[model samples]
Target: MEGKNIIYLNDIDGKTRAFTIKVKVVRLWKRSNPKKAGETWAIDMVLMDEKGTKMQATVWSNDFKKHEKILQQNECYTVFKPRFDKNNQKFKHFDTKYVLTFNLETTIRKCNNFIGPTHGFEFSTFKSIKNGGVSSEFRTDFIGYVEEWFAREDTTTRYGKQSYKMDLILRDLEGIALKLTLWEEYCDQMQEYISKNKEEEHIVLIVQFGSVHDYKGTINVANAYYITKLFINERNEEIVNFKRSYIGKASVTTSTHRSIGQSGVTSNEDEFLHNTTFSTIRQIREIAQVMHVIVVGTVMAVDKDSEWYYLGCESCNCKASPSLQFPEDDNGSDDVDPKEVLVCTNKKCKRDVVPAVHMYKVSIQVEDCTGIVNLTLFDRDTVKLWGLSAKQLVDKYLQVSDDEKTIPAEFNAFINKKYAFKIHVKKYNVDNKVDGFSINKLVDDPAIIAKLEKKFDVVPFEEFDSMILPTTVSSSQSDAGVKDSKSYAVDDSTPLPKNYESRKSPCDLKRTLEDSNDLDNSYSVSSTKSRKIETKEDIKAQMKDKLLIPKLEK
Candidate 1:
């Protein structure tokens, strides 16, 4: 609906037009240039009209100072003659294809009596998020209760600066759980709330416009760079209704796992195992997408052709494979030769030529009654089965044997041993029709194995080699045969992409209890202070070394 004098947000087309609209500044953030640090590129905002329709608006660097203080978030403003432009960014805030632009002729006037919604939140369902129904190009809102949480991790980033991160398992109203990761200041906000509200039984949290990610075979959600908002146990209608629905539910009980000096792998493995379904080795090969499954298989042989362990970065645990390192100061000695050392392949990692830790990367032939498949066991799961770190085993093997490819006696113990392996089937494996799988976790407990065997039908070990698969078992049939777990667990062992950027906090007006009814409470887990801009010299050095810093996702 359009009036004679005012225009709506959804009515404007990407063309030269003169229009006026009285809208509320739902959210606004300043984007910085990737090439020049601290240089503000544009002031972006999400504006909502009287009809609760949201649209993106932008104020360029030249006009940012003019409207920086004049336009406040959650405040009503009548913007006149704003230009319409196409939204061409790789990552956008909302589904609006066209964005409003502020030119030199654009006029802004405050509207104190404008009747409209202050916030626009379109919450997405767990079913959509779990099945890849939501587009990752745009962030979406999610509401869930915290079922379990891990301790806040205080670690150093590649920049040598200390950072904090925390992981939480969130469950929706339908008993569907998914992993959510909070980084940096977000971690502090949740930790502070937990410390203060230790007696709170149910903590219903809401994340507005959170980025959904699919790591390996697991689907998880995380707060993207500055644009995401958080609300935890707030006295709001949405959260109140959500908490009231789970009043008598025993499954919604919270459990906090303090991982201080404990093995982080145990929690990861437990979450993975709880979510994955049991399948035979033959069923795993027919997977159409990236999926994780449990299979009881016997280790037939250790693939000794490949190295069992690899040198990984000390800080990030990424594989490091740089060229041979020569002595910096040789003193003109010709007798000394260059020593080969493992360097972090991640360009962002500042620790250059540092010591590398030995991490397991063993491949073994695992055979079940259905079929035989190769499984690559990474460090954590390998340590769980071997009862020794890769470094310890390598050291012991080196003391006796010098050949790097030689199978150690310790590793041979896996041969002929039956264990339940959690296999991560990647998209690459499906597309390339590969039978190999990555072992994310392993279970050797006899009681647990017996229970799993009793639940699922398995052929005898004697007929494992001579087993014949049914030709009628299609990929759809295989998937439908197994029980799909509702838990959207995350695989933390996977590394983030090299070009992946971190989040930056956005500045907004903090709302009070008297803000508005039905949409009044929200706590942003972000700093309002400006982030430290990188110097041009620092950027130049990085550019010369081909080590560009990760930029904030806009």
Candidate 2:
């Protein structure tokens, strides 16, 4: 391995281009284009030099086929005349400032006598990860052993599509535990391994290039889309040494139970939920990221004037909207129901037309000592609250009355009721200045409510009358780094904003329903430029129809 002609990864600079270098393909993955179906975006990889320095590199979709068969993970090759580009992506796997790109003239040849470490990993400590000392912008590697694992779950993603996920409690050698989530194929791999090794203890897991997330002030790791590599109980040198040194020692114990969502809550998640104090409605509004918090509030009133349910796609549960293209009755059949043939608002849905299912979207005004805010209950939470699915309620009300707006008498169960609501506040709500929060989990059990009330020093329900909604949000709230507030309303007869077509999250549907009329609120979207800003008086004037959630100082 000799020569002054060979370039190393660290030798690249701003002016470097079309250079020859010898590096090992430590990792390789095919990047998919989310916008285009079945289309690859690029061929991405991590390349390590002879000195153990690594750099990010890619082959564009146009040139991917040229080197698809030649490039292999853990194989060293001499890459010739590859162009250099700045590594400025939002999520990066390495610390290199520049990434190599294969161009028309780029060539490669296998290096037979390559000498260097086959793998390069710089793992962060569990303490540093929990303390927020590591940079979350770049992906990092971490290794731990599975102390406890949850059963695989089939859950809906943010877009309302069904997906598989698995949760595990991983403990490092230092006795610190961390939560890890595996999505889709990763779950299948883990399940396969578990099925083969029934009695095996101390399952080691190494998450390579995993994404770090801070949820509710606790750090967790999840496998990234395609570039993440998962090594489960592999007989690598580090894993062998880790198991040999700590196999027979005393291990930490954790008791897990199935939570409301049929998912097991890890020890850390349980601590954050039960041990932490409740968050007031005022504090919930100040949150600018995705978080879960418990809030105790009395349901002042329900908006029975609006329709309480929307039709969702049967395939994915996304809100369905009327499409210009109706079902074709080739045989002149009478079986096609116009209500059933609707377009799924979720872009991920593959079908052009899908049958619809009734999903609840009940908005209620909730009041606590802090302030009054609107909370919308989706299908699952509403079903738990009323003990009836949206379809069953709709059928019951249709039998007794002809008016669709008249809610079932059973809906009165929510009025004047005090309950602990686990609200999931998303950044979409904060960014769009939407006041209505979505309830993911609702606890009405008297025992749990009483415990929470005693823990938070609760004020009696009679005293909530003194806590009135604020008429105007303080201008200082904007100066405190919160984004500028804007109000948007959609006119169903008009076309929606172009970007709105891609907005498929549950929060987006809730925001639209809050701003628009009941008849066509399911998939409505309005542009900021077309809507006029409402003043304080205008906001206060609409309080009778839409109760304004005030952003007040804590």
Candidate 3:
């Protein structure tokens, strides 16, 4: 009964029930061999019996002359055989045990039996089960923070209008879970629910059915399907424990399942990834002007000279303990350490790989949108546009210590300094939490590489402008003890050289100067302030430097 070749068996719900179902027939159609749609008998309708049991009422020469009343609209009869509609894409079934027919084979009976609701498969309990495949339709209460939301498009047609869709990550008491696709009108409603409450606060919902289809070994839900109801039912600490039938025990069939829903609305994207509103490279540059954008992908090649930072393990945040510089290479031997290192921050690489170079190079990764593509920092141009370092720009988004410098244990465990460092992280992010998730205008234009590069004077890595300078020197040489002195038309109290002025002050000027000197050494004025002097050497040297040029090679 549990395997195959079985009838009158207990259903998946564990209900021990069987019935000799009955049916009353008012109308029937004889399935025929008349070719329709280039096929013989494209599955015509069926008439079932009063016991809900099936028997073929074949349309033959005998039936054409029999049971004329069953074809009448107001007339009724007891009939046999049932036909279920089949979608072309879905597998079609012809009930072999109860073949469909036309004319009645039995008497019409008036029995009292009606269809009942709440009929579906049962699911296994999530607890007390380590792992197994899950299949069922159920109802249960569940809660999860809004990790992410995907809204779908809708359209209209001759069969009235269509609807939208929603995909979300739903976590519960059992554990983190996978994709829940919402169909029809529920899609739009879920969209509104998501936009309003995108934070990590718990949200409760009831799931009717899901995990019906496995896409790429990952459960995926599509439109034209099942239903799930998500609502904020009663808030206690804004959390409620309810039940959903769709939620059930999921078992690990294998490790390559590529877990879904774990990367929900708030789930950190791949380490070192920065998803931007911009999709094109042009757009990437526009945002790079003010904010540094970094997306994480696989390492095609590490920078040749990239400094390797040591970590304890690839999968642990426990940084390796270290002393200082490497011990001097004694006895003409090379220096090496046994420490494990990471070129990237992925804490899960199975093997150690080094960065290809010191300068930022493109990393490749497989993404749903762009497969096996490079993720870059928009550096080629934005480095010149925005002078802000990616590190400093990221600092503004950091949630600073407001608890009187008491560092949270999670952060303290990974950090060794009191201040921000150029430490790489598992996620590249915009300070969306800052200012209502909208970065300031300074960070809006992502293509500001040209603007950023202007702030730093670009010199070769080894060249230093402020460190040293060389210049041509002549008469006024500091190294030769030359000092600039006040210039005068003539030396004081001495006969002037030929062509030098030796003129004495006029009698009136002399009298005024004598009176001014007699009154005070300073009348809020210094004697040097009034002195103005120029020399032939100063003008000739200035002109020569501006105009002189060496002769070109002949």
Candidate 4:
């Protein structure tokens, strides 16, 4: 083989072995290290021979521009007089013990007769990655469909370098969802693909040389190194078969699964309904995000203190607050009507106040034997439950006497009534609880309620005690050294002791403390009159007696 001008990747050694071999550029990327001095960029590439042997190769910054355009991916090329270096195992992404480096004398020419393998990807399944035991130094290839993607965010790393990151939820053939992160150039590439192919559904993502990481208990895959490459919806036999077998036939149309009750009042209520698993209020609160669950509870009370309706702009349908402008001669009187004179806060809606529409924003507190939670019903769900629009409710309230400006009796019908709520739990954030609940479907059918009641009766509370219950920490046993101990009752209806203080949600307490701190930082004038300032000359004379004079050195 050596006499025929052919050398395999396994034959390469750190010695100055001169050879000409045909190989294909499998992957290539630029590596930038901020900690390095000038010219800190290098072009890295993975080359595979015709025999399926792979090795790492690099073009240093000085020679990168001259050879970068010549090294086309998947194209066969014959390299002459290439230098061999002992592979750095710590940064190696291939299986070879030696790596190739191009120098000033190294020459490369296109090999028309020989075509080598474009890539040597060893694909791994998400199940195997989740089971662990994979070496951190090893890089794996993965392929899946994009289940969902989040907007890209600019972030600053601890090294004081700026980069962009985007999160993607990838679903495998087995319907298991795994989170994949794209950083820097990869993020920009994916974002561009998404924007250009907005109408192209069923995009298959192929990630080569991605690192498997275990964050907390969830396993995910991310770009391993700078040379990690991404392919989207490429025309290949493996990807084509994957889509056909796992994602169904290409002729079949995929259904768009939108969230329930999001399509306004015209959407079919039954279309979004699901026969979800029954859970208690406590269980629902503790469940993970995006889970569909059914909770049966009685409306304990109506929080009328919160606004039942908000003024929204007609064009954008965004909530609008009243403008601060008022009549000069009004004398800050209460007779001024806000709805008649207010302006929409949305900058897009430059129209008058008459175009503002009324939207419902109702808050109801519901409770079961286990626990309690506040459910926020939006416009569509609010009208479905109350059988009246916010404008109609406002009209009815205005018909009553001026002294009775309270919530109408029609809204109070939900109090003390039992109903099963189908909800898709939003992700919980420690700083905000209001965004954690989204009511999907409201079920009032007696037969469905009866079936759920029978199902709950068969299951014992002890079964879910370990799974859904929130762990409690006693004050005496807490590691924070908190001495004031308090206990929470499972049954929310039970009255608390006189000394027991009610607990507020973390979000509410955080906001309250922040507001108090802002108030404390403001300067307050004690008197209505302003004090006169002393001139610089007056201050100098006043400090003359206190001023110290240094003696002259002899």
The best candidate in terms of TM-score: 2
Model 2, CA-based lDDT: 0.65
- Candidate 3 per-residue lDDT, tens place, 1-554, comes to 11121122111122322222233332244344545544334222323332333222334445544544334321223232212112332222222333333433422232222222111212333331113244322222234433345557565544786745557655545565545667666677666555653322224444422334445555443332322333432222112212111122332111112212233432222211233222211122123223433321112221122221222321222233333333222122336444332343445643233211112121211111111122222221122223322222233434473332232232222111111001111112222111001111112122332222222221211111122213244543423321121111211233323322232211111222222222221111111232222243432342234432233454
lDDT of 4 at 350: 46
lDDT of 2 at 395: 89
Question: In order, what lDDT does every prediction score?
Answer: 0.64, 0.65, 0.29, 0.59
Best by lDDT: 2
Tens digit of lDDT per residue, candidate 4, span 1-554?
Answer: 32256677787765546787778787777778667855457778888888877788888878866687788665667787788877775676765677888878787876544444445666788777778755557678888877678888999977998888988888788877889999988888888877754434456788988888877887788887576888776534445446545545222222232221121212222332333577766555345455667877667555655677787754445676665543221122345433324566767764444235567777666655443556666664565455456776787777774533377788767776777776666544222222235565565565555555543321222221222223354543334321111111233333333422332211112222222221221111111121212232322333232323332455
Alpha-carbon deviation at 347 in model 2, angstroms: 43
lDDT by residue (155-261, candidate 2, tens digit) is 99989999999998888878888999999998888877887654243467888888898888988989887778887765444554455444434422112222322
User: Using alpha carbons, what is the TM-score of model 1?
Assistant: 0.44
Pick out the ten consecutive residues of candidate 4 with the lowest summed lDDT. 518-527
Model 1: weakest 10-residue lDDT segment is 519-528
lDDT of 1: 0.64
lDDT, candidate 3, equals 0.29
Worst 10 residues of 2 by lDDT: 521-530
